[model samples]
Target: MTIYGSALIVFVLMALPLYGLLLTSFQPEAVIRSRDVQFLPATLYLDHFRSVLAPGHIVPIREGIWNSVVVSTLTAAVCLIVALPAAYALSRLRLPGKNLMLGAMVSVYFLPTTIFLIPMFVLFVSWGIDDTFFSLVLAYAGFILPFEVWILKTFIDRLPREVEDAARMDGCTHLQVMRHILLPLVRPGILAGFIFAFILSWTEFLTPLIFTSDIKISTVALGMFRSTIDIQVGQQAAAAVLTLLPVALLMIVFQRLITQVLMAGADR
Candidate 1:
């Protein structure tokens, strides 16, 4: 009973804000502006959602969404590519200063992003690549790569090496063994890494806002900032919901795998 009570309390605390946001998105503007708590409403007012999707907005929702998708997809893909090799090397080979390298990577990821902003911005400016999707993707990949590498390394370590040895004995090269065996086994870790990386890239606001100057090149997250002042509260709520919906759905689908990944990582 105590455990169930604690779970219920935690659920309510966690879910209250989300439930409120959902309710507010479907609420009348007057109710929102008036700051009245209408736990339930007689009818759903969808004008806010309509306004968010309506044509002729300063922040082009479609373009911003496409940009977010592109940045997030590219970030995850790049992280996966770079992390796979790095993780395999660390897991399988005895590399010099491996622990130092791991600590440095962790430190970089743990440090506040603001610490790198000004210097990275200047560096990008020098290269004339500031404010481009390529720049944004690269920035996000830098952050995601370390975390992905750690997750993949841990997972790879957990994998049975007997299979790889058998394949090697059967005349398979290391690359062939990895291609035909190891990757298929650690599919869950790869998927978890991708999903987490994609979500981080998708929801990133400050980095994109600081680096990007083009309105058309903005992400859905950055677009929210621009629209917040001009739009009604309900409309803002609707936009937030729209941006959050995909991520929420993705989490719901992979939640079990993610939980297992976390538990396994903890054990390792």
Candidate 2:
């Protein structure tokens, strides 16, 4: 009963903003201009959706979408590339002071990313890559690597050592065992890490704001600010809704995988 009550309360809290998002998205511009907050609209309108889809802004909605997708996908991919081996080493190998290194990594993760913004910007500008897609991907991947490493490390730690040993005994090389056996076994954790990294990059406002100057390379989160400046309330709501669409679709598609991956660590 206590759990049910707590769940109901949490649901209501989450539902409130979502309800407003829906209501505002469907409301007519005239209704919005009147400055009244109506929980229920008598009717629906979609001119806002049309406008959001149109190309009228400094950064076209389409291009922002493309840039965001590219940056996020690359960040996720690159982060995993860096994290997987490190995680495997920490989990399976007799690395020197592995616990201390992990604690340090966790400390880095917990440290406010904003603290590094100015220094990172300086480094990027020095390297002549400031305001570029690569800069954003690098920044996001750096920030996301710790979590991905930790998550994958947890997953790796749980795998049976006997299986890996058996594979080695069968003349399977270490690379072959990892590629064929271990990676496939922990795929859900990897997928979850990818999703996490992607979403972190996608929704990130600070890193993109600092690193991106070209409208052509701007992301959806930054584009929202520029696109909605002179737009009506309804259109703004539509833009917000559209920004959430890809994330929503991703969650819908990977919900089960994410659940399994998250649960896989919880039992430890």
TM-score of each: 0.94, 0.90
- How many clashes would you count in candidate 1? 0
Determine the C-alpha RMSD for candidate 2 after optimal superposition of all C-alphas: 2.3
Q: Show pairs that collide, candidate 1.
A: none
lDDT of 1 by residue, 71-140 (tens): 9999999999999988888888779988888778977899899988889999999999998998899889
C-alpha lDDT of all candidate models, in order: 0.85, 0.84
- For each of the candidates, give the backbone clash count: 0, 0
How many backbone overlaps does candidate 2 show? 0
- Top lDDT hit: 1
Decoy 1 TM-score against native: 0.94
Q: Candidate 1 local accuracy as lDDT? A: 0.85
